[model samples]
Target: MRQRNLSIPRTSVTALVAAMAAVLYLCLAALPVHAAEGFDFYTDSPGIHVTAGDALSFNLHLAGSNAAGSDVALSVASMPEGFTGFFKSGSYEVTKVHASGDGADTIATFQTTVPSDVADGVYEIVLHAASEGGFEDDLILTLTVSGLESGESNFHVEYPDQEGVSGTAFSYSTTIANNTLNTQNYNFSSNAPAGWTVAFSSESTQVSSLEVESGSSKSVTITVTPPEKVEAGDYTVECAATSAKEQLSTALNVKILGTYGLDLSTTDGRLSFDAFANKESSVTLKLTNSGNIALENISLTSSAPAGWEVSFDSSVIDALEPGASKEVVAHVVPGKDSLTGDYVTIMSASCDNQSAQASFRITVKTQTGWGIFALVIIIAVAAGLYGVMKKYGRR
Candidate 1:
């Protein structure tokens, strides 16, 4: 065998090696890129369904990867109008969440509220998470709000008209209903005229706030008191119920009835008078209505000592307006043999609703006939003595 010396070219070898390297580079570039291990975010329920004036809640979980732990800031990017939301961990609010290494999980709860006047439709909300380690993620949440078929409100107030006196307390029974699917705490309040006091109570216990379960009702008593000197008229009271999700108010009409009172006294400001036996005396008596309402069919009467007669000019009055006064002449006569002493008589003025009485003192004096008789007797005695003296002188 002839050993022929055959050698390959260096350029060919170089070109072959270059082609293989190019093919390897292309394969490596085509492979998928792996993300760095940091934080992963997810939720148990992505789509939530609820009714109007309802509250929805879900659990959010953060899973850690092979990288170091980081603090993730959580927030709600967008929500419907008149909607509110918050995040909580255990019993406290969670503004920032922490994720540990070694594939640990951190959980936080998210709560959202739907307003009572929200329309029936599907809404979208965005939940976002960010960290200093160049970690950012967001998830889209779906919220479905439905309305009742009967078109009834979730919260309502029931109250009726009330009536009372001006200087007294007015009370009424009210009912509040929670027709939603969640329990709610309601605050009670009212608006009234100036210088008026209002209060609320439940089951005979005073309360500023109360709690009612879902689809249930609560009985509340509202008491309103007007000012001590308020005028008699028609008034209105507005009572309200406030909660985290809804507010309701109702008006109650109040009718005020007036009070009636009468006062009786002597017109001359003297409770005593002087009279002799078998004599008649005249006195003036005054009657006044001091209350807010008018007095009708007012009658007068009197009580005197034995054998004494009392009479009035007019015994009955048709009507007496408020704060008005009337005067009547009263004629009083003593008995035939009345002794010289003080006498007391009670005069009363009465109306339909009220009455008053006053006492009068009368002092009796001796008759004039007895004085004339005593003077005649004294003159006769003097004439008789003069006659006797003259007769003796002549003898």
Candidate 2:
């Protein structure tokens, strides 16, 4: 049972994570602004909860002594997803977009619309008003939607492999499945991992949900391009299926497969060298396959600073059995007139777009010119004192 490298595959894993994020935005409902300035505004019911794509009207009363009938300018500052702020006559009504308002109150009223594909949770709507008598008011109204309607759509995320990946870009595929009877139109969405892009068939594009027939299914493929600097890790995201009839949602979990691409000189994974100008040193690389799946066509590449050079004996490997291990070597050298102190370079191993890098350091030392002059001055002084002592002995 050799220790397997725990690097994730870059391209495949990234794509999957991006898809999950897109779906998450649609399932989790954004809460409306819940802070307001009014007569010590408080909700008698604590909060109102609702599901994605559902609509409701709530009656909130403004109770204050000597504050009634004073022209209060009611304004809604914020609202949750799929909701708009407006006013009817006096009562607060939450409806879909394009729904009519009932004009009833002399003072301004606030209304909103609830989107059909939002998630279940509590949302906030902030209300504010001011009076001529120097009285001001604010309120935090709670809106909660629970559970899913149509309940037939689900989303699942898949990463490339969990062990490790070498490249910067990962490819992910998302399957948006419709489990209900009626044909549904859906919007495919995701939030990609940091430094990554989500592309569908047309380069990480957005897509509408497929119209699935009863007992049938459809899926969309999304490609994720992660930044070249991302490391391996576990990431989760939410995905949703949206249509005019109703919305459905599911969670996606992804694991990029492969070992982190860098290799090591010592078992503790440290690079080693001594100060030497115009000399080269040898370092060993112990490559590990951290991914669940085997890797193929592995190769090494390098980058160095001025006056420093690097090369590798083995640039490519054929196959890495899952959980297997192998080794390679890298050479570092400084030019004849290279400066001293510390010189650094980076070596990357890439398979397709997946890659990883190892940092290299070199030290230089020179014992010429000024160094030789100092040594000669010290020797001459010592010789002169020896000559004077010899003259005294002869006398």
Q: Count the backbone clashes (under 3 Å) in each candidate.
A: 0, 75
Model 1 CA deviation exceeding 4 Å by range: 1-48, 51-86, 95-108, 113-142, 147-151, 154-159, 261-287, 295-321, 326-395
CA-lDDT, candidates in order: 0.79, 0.58
Model 1 lDDT per residue over 47-111, tens place: 86777877778777765552246777889988888988998888998988776633334457788
The 10 consecutive residues of candidate 2 with the worst lDDT sum are 96-105
lDDT of 1 at 175: 80
Query: Could you give me the TM-score of model 2 versus the true structure?
Result: 0.39
- Which tens-of-lDDT digit does each residue in 1-395 have in candidate 2? 99988877899799999999978876564532322232433334546555555444444444454345555445676676567666555344432112111212123334456676666667888765555555556666777666644555665445534223434344456565655444556765666656656554422445544565544665556555544445556655455666665566555444544344333334458764665666787677777765555668988777877676778788888887666777777777777787777777777777763456777666667746778899999999999999999989787
lDDT score, candidate 2: 0.58
> 18 in model 2: Cα distance from truth in Å?
87
Q: TM-score of each candidate?
A: 0.46, 0.39
- lDDT of candidate 2 at residue 296, scale 0 to 100: 81
